[model samples]
Target chain A: MIGAGVLWWLSAPDDITRPYAADVTPDIQAGALVFAAGGCASCHAAPEAKGDAKLHLAGGLAFDSDFGTFYAPNISSDAAAGIGTWTLEDFARAVTKGVSPQGRHYYPAFPYTAYARMTPQDVADLHAYMATLPADATPSKPHDVGFPFNIRRSVGLWKFMFSDTRDVLTDAQTPQIARGRYLVEGLSHCGECHTPRNALGALDRNAWLSGAANPSGKGRIPGITPAQLDWSEADLIEYLTSGFTPDYDSAGGKMADVVANLAQLPEADRAAIAAYLKALP
Target chain B: MTGFTKTILGTGLCAALIASAGFAASHSSVTNKAVAARHAQMQMIGYHTGVLGAIAKGEMEYDSAMVDAAATNLRELAKLDGTTMWVAGTEQGATDGSRAKAEIWSDAAGFAQKFTDLENAASAMIGAADAAAVGAAMGGIGGSCKGCHQDYRGPKS
Candidate 1:
């Protein structure tokens, strides 16, 4: 029994395949909105890409943290330098499982733990939208981490401890809150940054979105769980859409990108997000 | 030996208390004024940016006059010399009630350049609003704000 269990643990599956229909047409327009809602441009766009040029996902932004500097890689459709040659199955695995086409483990900075909760249909739609973007040939940059953090295989252990493919809210009475949970817990990946992490770096799920110290050591990521945050649903919606607090202060810091993404979503979607936030325990 | 040591220690503690009272009196009142001024300046900037941002996001319909007025105010705010309002030692971790980082003082030139960029963006926005294209001009303004904020300010503590 012990030998059998060891083999099972050692041979954890590398891929969870979701087959693509050979000719199933995806809604490119809907996928475009999901791209914005996921805030891909805010991080993946070339640093100086302004105006409509922001659509180019050549990816060179560096996220400096206490762990080390993480450079966002090029996810463009250029075959030589990007994911152009990847199959739909490979893209789905990368997004949800944080695995590469070559069977390498991806750093959680990619936030697949949250993306794991995304519907496979949306993943296919997103793949369709990305196909239309202008693909640049910029090569990916290496991370600047040191010591144990650099080991890719160790990520599987971390994944085993923290990664969950389950929905954040399995039971919901209202459709609005349910939709909000999908966006927040999945595509938006708000909890990835907002929730505090354990000593081992996995999210302290108990704290949820109650905020934590920023990994950069420069500032704190303020708590947003209902216990610490008291914004009403209307105020929360306004904040999401306008980047303004009820006190008239404009949002600063990383939240600006989040607001920009939320601004693109419809008023009803924004309301749903607010409803979900308000309902969080 | 013990009596002498106790008397000296008692006198030393009393003198320390008086010295602290004097030090507290000297810094507290003066420090509050600069902090308050900085807060007021930020609020003024927020007031102008709030309206322009609302219009830019299509949350409110374009009213040329409101757009022009808010844009004008923000340009002027950007131009205002905040040297006095941003007095030294008013940063986060140094003191309460401020999120500005100490780096703002050390890198005054960098901060000034960001301010100039904001000024330039606002001026361009003013021209855009005049031509009924404030929406197009909003990106420059947002980018300018982000450029400075990414470096100088600490997190919302």
Candidate 2:
């Protein structure tokens, strides 16, 4: 029993000793773009928030899953209730490693698995931008998950088993496609919803962007594969910017939020996403 | 009553009876009809929104007459009560091709407010001075459509 406990303790991720460069001044403007791509407000902002209010990041949205109901916590700069006091390194580990400042494992619901691929510079930039947003002091609501899933340590084991860091697409033909690959697989985390998941809730890398049963229940999230979505590259870019399908049906559900974020990005970025998707076999 | 009027009323009654009888086994004809009506209205809204969008994107030339007609059509559509078309049991799983989430019926007031939002936005479009004005108003109009669809509409089945 003693040896097993020791193993469990040792299995917990080591404290992040790697320091974020202290002298490198982050570009807040670029960080804003990174924030838009990340769609941080989609989950962290209050459900009723709109327009500029989305920047608050007070975090009361509920994400229902098979394991349990997980609430997006307060990520605003509130000194006590939020991450206002966190250093850039602390924020980086939480974003990339899924470990908290106190060294606890966060549930995979945070999508740190996808964020693990982000460049450290981008992480630092994002931290700087978030620091500029308005702070909210709303306390986070506790998740309603039942054990043994409630035991946070189990996530460490799951991460060890399923957290694959290999890039999804290796044969990018251009720098544009490479940028698309990074945004899609890393910061945008499009596969989080668009891809099917195994019983354990980890994304099925084999089925990347091929669609899944909508976790919110009652309908399937449509696949965006070449076979499923035969839209032209131009069509894809327009839809991302305008939310209008070729059929003139407007986007609904969570996709509207995604469209709002994508619309803020340059047309070139949307074009890049289009090119990458078209390139997918 | 005139002979023509009587004949028309008789035909309508016969058709209604036939429809009810054909669907009597599952007794979902009323629900199906309601869902169909709502879907038709939504398609009309989409059509007008597309017209305005094309003008805004410069894909279609901005003619004042065309703009007025489309904006008026949108305003009238938004003003429609549509209460009967969104009846209970007409949610996504209850009817075919609905894509109407249960929240439409459960949170009836919120759903109604979305229509009001559309109405106000369409009113703004109608009052816009020119093509540039309409283009400026398109964001709010589109946002109102999305506001409801985001919360109340389901994925395409």
Candidate 3:
């Protein structure tokens, strides 16, 4: 038991100390683009928030999964209740390494596994941008996970065993394809829903972008592999921009929110994503 | 008279002469009939929406008459009472292939509001002068469809 305890202690991810050793001034405008690409407002904003209300980032939506219901916490600029108190290093470590400012491990429900691959520069930019958003003083909600999964220490072991951020698509030849791969594999985190999860809730990388059972247990999310989708690049560009399928079916459910965010991106970015999907072998 | 005139005259005479005529009730189950009716209603809506969407996307040449007709059809469809087809207990798991969720009945007012949004959007679209105007209206029309589906429609089975 003592040996096991020691191993567990050593497994916790180290806090990122002074992540920006040299002063690198973040571009707030570029960070807004990153914010759009990340879809930060989808889960963090109040549930069903529309228009400018989504910009508040007050964070009260409940995400139901097998383990438990995870609530998105307040990431607004409130110094008392939000990340406004966090330093750049604190934000960077939490985002890229899933380690908290207090050294606790955040549950993977936060999607840090994908955010782990984000560039340090992007993380800095995002942090700067989030600072400009409206502040909400709502206290962060506690997660309702049970028993062994509830223990934050156990998450350390899980992270040690499963946190693999290697490039999933090795053959991204063009720069556009490479950018698509970065967004898909990292900030956009499409695999969080598209890829199946193992017994431990880690994404099954081998079946990347193939849809899985809806986490809420209503119905199956459709597979988007080239074999399954079969939409031309133009069809995808149109769908991403306008939420219309080739057959005139409108996108429904959570995907509608995703399309709303993707629509805000540059047309080139949408085309790049389509090109990447086409290149998937 | 022309064939078109003869067909219109025949339809009018048939409607006048067949007043109060009774027909056999449909043999389909009540649940099946309700679900099927809603499916047909939705298809009609989709078809009209697509007609406008094609013009908005520049895939179809914009004809003022065609655009007006499609937008009018959508407004009329939205105004129709959908209660019979949206009967309670016809939600997703209660019947196969029905994507309607229980919230349709539990939160009936919210669902009705979605229809109102569609009706208003379609009414605004009726006199759109050009493809650009139609394209601008598609945002509201399509957004109303998506907003309701996001909350009240279940995933495909």
Candidate 4:
């Protein structure tokens, strides 16, 4: 029995260990840029409206979903209150597998299911960038959710139902397109906003890019699929560069802030983004 | 016809259709086009003026004279007829590939207020072309741009 237990312990997968290699610093930096593009700070950061901007990623943003009011948790580097003690493997597992450092299940509100397609290098870069932030010692806030949601283990079932743990696949036939795909599907996570959700809040893969209501309770995020946006490559490029649509109109609300960041990026990267978005099926 | 020939013919037809659609889509009200062109020109002027103003104030040092000249041009550009440029359905120009949100249309008054704010700020910059006051001008102009952009621009990613 002792020998069997030892064998089981040795064979049992450690939730934290990830299949990652070093020497991916450049890719990691690029991934950090991609993370910025994805606007992770906008949602994950504590709300500035309530006058506490210093909280950083000590998440307190409330996201009201059909499941319930889901408050974001503190993801800082605090040893006691945050993930300060977490290993790179632990961070990767949380981001890629939706498993907390302590092996607890994380709610889908954390976006790990979509982030699962991210390259390990990108994840590492994001991890590195996150590590540089000032550690806040705020304790993790409990979810206001009731019933089954209150039981954190329920996320295991949620994972089984909706998680797609595949890395972003790139085709050699179109390297630029492939880069765009990786950037969009992985770090950018565009589908999180544009793709509609089902009753279970899982993305409806078949009707991908068809447009959906914003999860933040703002206006509907329009579909940018070729069929819907009908934008030329130049149009997309201009829009990305200047935040103006080809029709000379400006985007509004959160999108405006997003454009501001994109506008500051290198033109070549913007063109690549335009090219990729146009090619989306 | 052979398969290659059929494919070529189909692609050619599709290309023609797309071209026609693009052409039709390109058409806009002549008046609106003029207004949009003027607005775009003003935007460029505002951008340059801000840069120049920064230089003049010693906060930045790129080209003070050139920036001052650009600010003059912007003052002139802002004087053009902008009556219909920011109207509903006219917020975006044919060449402007912006994701102009519906709020611009739904809340036209507030949107127009931003334009007025921009014009006022730009006009003020021209009056105070002195190095000492350039910083203030920069702030005013930037404030207007931010005011409009905050509510209207799309996400960059």
True contacts kept of each: 0.36, 0.57, 0.53, 0.21
| C-alpha lDDT of residue A100 in model 3 | 88
Residue-by-residue lDDT tens digits, candidate 2, A1-281: 99888659755874554766565678888899889999999999998798899999999899999999999999998999899999998998899889999988898889888888888778889999999999999999999999889988888888877888688887999999998888888899998999999999999989999999998887889899898898889779878987876545668899999999999998888998989898888
How would you encode candidate 1's per-residue C-alpha lDDT over B1-157 as one tens digit per residue?
3576446434543443443344334334334677767665665665566566656655455566666787888888888888788888788767765668777899899889988998888788774553238767866776676666656777865
RMSD of 4: 11.9
What's the C-alpha lDDT at position A242 in model 3? 86
Docking class of 1: incorrect
Q: How would you encode candidate 4's per-residue C-alpha lDDT over B12-130 as one tens digit per residue? A: 43443454344334433334464445445544544454344435434343334544565666656655545555445644332244335566778777766776776787667664546
Q: For candidate 3, lDDT tens digit of each residue in A1-281?
A: 99998877767676665646346778788888888888899989988799889988888899898888999999999998888999888888899889888989998988888998888778888999999999988888888899888988889888887888998899999999998888888998888988899999999989998889899888888878898788899989988888876655678888999899999989999998898888887
Count residue pairs with overlapping backbones in model 2. 0
Candidate 4 C-alpha lDDT tens digits along A19-108: 463556634556457556656666666664222353367777788887788877887767776777876778788887787767777788
- TM-score winner among the candidates? 3
lDDT of 1 by residue, A1-281 (tens): 99867645753546865464345567888888888888888888888566687888899999886678899999988887888888878888898889998888888889888888777777878888998888999998999988788877767777887787576666666999899998888898888889898887788777888888887676689888788778788879977876666544556667877787788889988998888888887
* DockQ computed for model 2 against the true two-chain complex using alpha carbons: 0.27
Decide which is better by lDDT, 3 or 4. 3
Ranking by DockQ: 3, 2, 1, 4
Off by over 4 Å in 4: A1-19, A22-32, A49-55, A165-173, A261-265, B1-157
* lDDT per residue as tens, model 2, B67-132: 678788988898888868778877787777678888887888999899999888888888566668
Distance from true location, Cα of A206 in model 4, Å: 0.9
lDDT of 4 at A192: 75
- The weakest ten consecutive residues by lDDT in model 4 chain B span B90-99
